[model samples]
Target: MEAKELEAEILRLVREMAPHLLDLLGVGPITAAQVLVSWSHPGRFRSEAAFASFAGVSPIPASSGLTNRHRINRSGYRQLNRALHTVTLIRTRLDPATKIYVARRMAEGKTSRDAQRCLKRTICRQIFKILEPPNRTRAASLTDHANQLDAI
Candidate 1:
């Protein structure tokens, strides 16, 4: 298999798997596929911390003999960072809450990068919230109700 042919094969497999992946995530196939693509790349994040660093959201600690400072980790996957940044930018434009949050951070004297990092963190939180599992206990209650009806 030539490199180009291998690449094509991988892409075909990804397309086939995308819908199932979306279904598992409980999201529309297109949206889930888009998220997967954004997070997928060679040499991309290997863990959440790495992804956080890549998104320029990880705080870098600096401490030296009574003087301490924190800064953004300026290393890791630039592509992922850029993707998160694009999302943040779009959110800022469309979401008034996000815009206000950014503005408030800026008013608090945060640098532009710092403000952006804040926005990125906010976006990450939202993403995680969407991807988190819902309560299964509620489903169990419905099942219990159905069982009672069956018993009657």
Candidate 2:
């Protein structure tokens, strides 16, 4: 297939895979697809923290006596990290929420790079939430239905 044709087909598949994620501000088709591919089965991750760890966004302990700092994690899915970075960069420029967050972090003595890292971490959490399966357990749904039958 021609490069342009292949690109178009991939974009189409990405849209079909996660239109809601694609609809999110700052998430392009590629970014949406990356998120979907990295988290094809969200149930594998028990929680957002697990997702963050999988993406290498969870903060690793770096405290040393009185001094404390977290180090940049150079592990996990690099493509996923890149996707989150892309979303963070776009949001820093366009999304009001991210702008406010970055500005607040900057005001609190964080450099733009640090603030962006923090924002990317935040994006990881959001991605996990978007990708994670609904919290309404099957038992809860059945219980609710049983209660409705009792009332009836």
Identify the leading candidate in terms of lDDT: 2
Q: Which ten residues in a row have the lowest lDDT in candidate 1?
A: 21-30
lDDT for model 1 comes to: 0.59
Instruction: Give per-model TM-scores.
Output: 0.52, 0.79
User: Residues 73-132, candidate 2, lDDT per residue (tens digit)?
Assistant: 678799998888888878888888878998898998877777877887888877777766
lDDT of 1 by residue, 43-113 (tens): 33344455566555787887689966567767765655665666767667777877798889989888777
What TM-score does model 2 achieve against the real structure?
0.79
Q: Least lDDT summed over 10 consecutive residues: which range in candidate 2?
A: 136-145
lDDT of candidate model 2 versus the reference: 0.78
Residue ranges of candidate 1 with Cα displaced over 4 Å: 1-34, 37-51, 63-68, 132-152
What is the lDDT for 107 in model 1? 93
Overall lDDT per candidate, in order of appearance: 0.59, 0.78
